[model samples]
Target: MDLTGTQRAGATPTWYEDALAWACRPVHHTTDISPLRAHAQAVGHTDGYRPHPPHRTRRHP
Candidate 1:
């Protein structure tokens, strides 16, 4: 998969996938990782951290 494309309309940033790959790589070797730790690793891979849309939370009625 190509990881060098610029963000297009209605598409996620390119770095997001790279970050995901980085995050998943460690899981293949280790089995006792926490989700929070994996998330942190993903975020760290995004160079300088690109501004992303805020995660939407479902409102309970």
Candidate 2:
């Protein structure tokens, strides 16, 4: 049978016919949160150690 273009030899749909096919399957996705957590912790630590000035003054005469 000529399966080129819109030609179908049977009653099965295009997707149904390729149910067990892995070539058109969705890929597995994953995200790593360790780096983000480390950055947040570093920022928090720096914020606690730094002292804020009580007043602002012009240094230039």
Candidate 3:
């Protein structure tokens, strides 16, 4: 999926702003193990939760 950040034109849309805010939201570190991460760890025996690798995009001049 193409993130809204790079697709915006003049006068940013509310959805794009919301998505940007969500993406830039502060994250707090804690000892807590999210249920989803815990389940994944339990099933996959991973050391921790890892998100998918970033998507690569091409820039056209």
Candidate 4:
């Protein structure tokens, strides 16, 4: 699938403005966060959220 971002010169969309629009609409059948990811995204905190980086990380030596 051609992500809207790909149409731009970047691999990913820089802002969520367009993304939010897409999310609001049921068009294009792609890019919708899965039920599982939606659950993670619904969490207020980023910890353990799949879409977000872990809240804390240990130094990798």
- Index of the highest-TM-score prediction: 3
Top candidate on lDDT is 1
User: How much lDDT does each candidate structure score?
Assistant: 0.44, 0.35, 0.43, 0.42
lDDT of 3 at 51: 32
Candidate 1 lDDT tens digits, 1-61:
6433454454655756666655444343555442223333464453433233233347778
Q: Write the per-residue lDDT of candidate 3 for residues 1-61, one digit (tens) a residue.
A: 6546556554455875455444444344533322222114465464533333343356778
The clash numbers for all candidates, in the given order, read: 0, 0, 0, 0
Candidate 4 on 1-61: residue-level lDDT in tens?
5557556667355455455444444333545433223233554753331342223335767
Model 1 score (lDDT): 0.44
Q: Model 3, residue 3: displacement in angstroms?
A: 11
Clashing pairs in 3: none
lDDT of 4 at 26: 34
Task: List runs of model 2 lying over 4 Å from the truth.
Answer: 1-7, 14-21, 24-61
Model 3 RMSD in angstroms: 15.8
The residue ranges of model 4 lying beyond 4 angstroms of the native Cα positions read 1-14, 27-61
Candidate 2 local Cα displacement, residue 20, angstroms: 8.6
**lDDT tens digits by residue: candidate 2, 1-59:** 44655445553666543543333233334232111122125644522122222333457
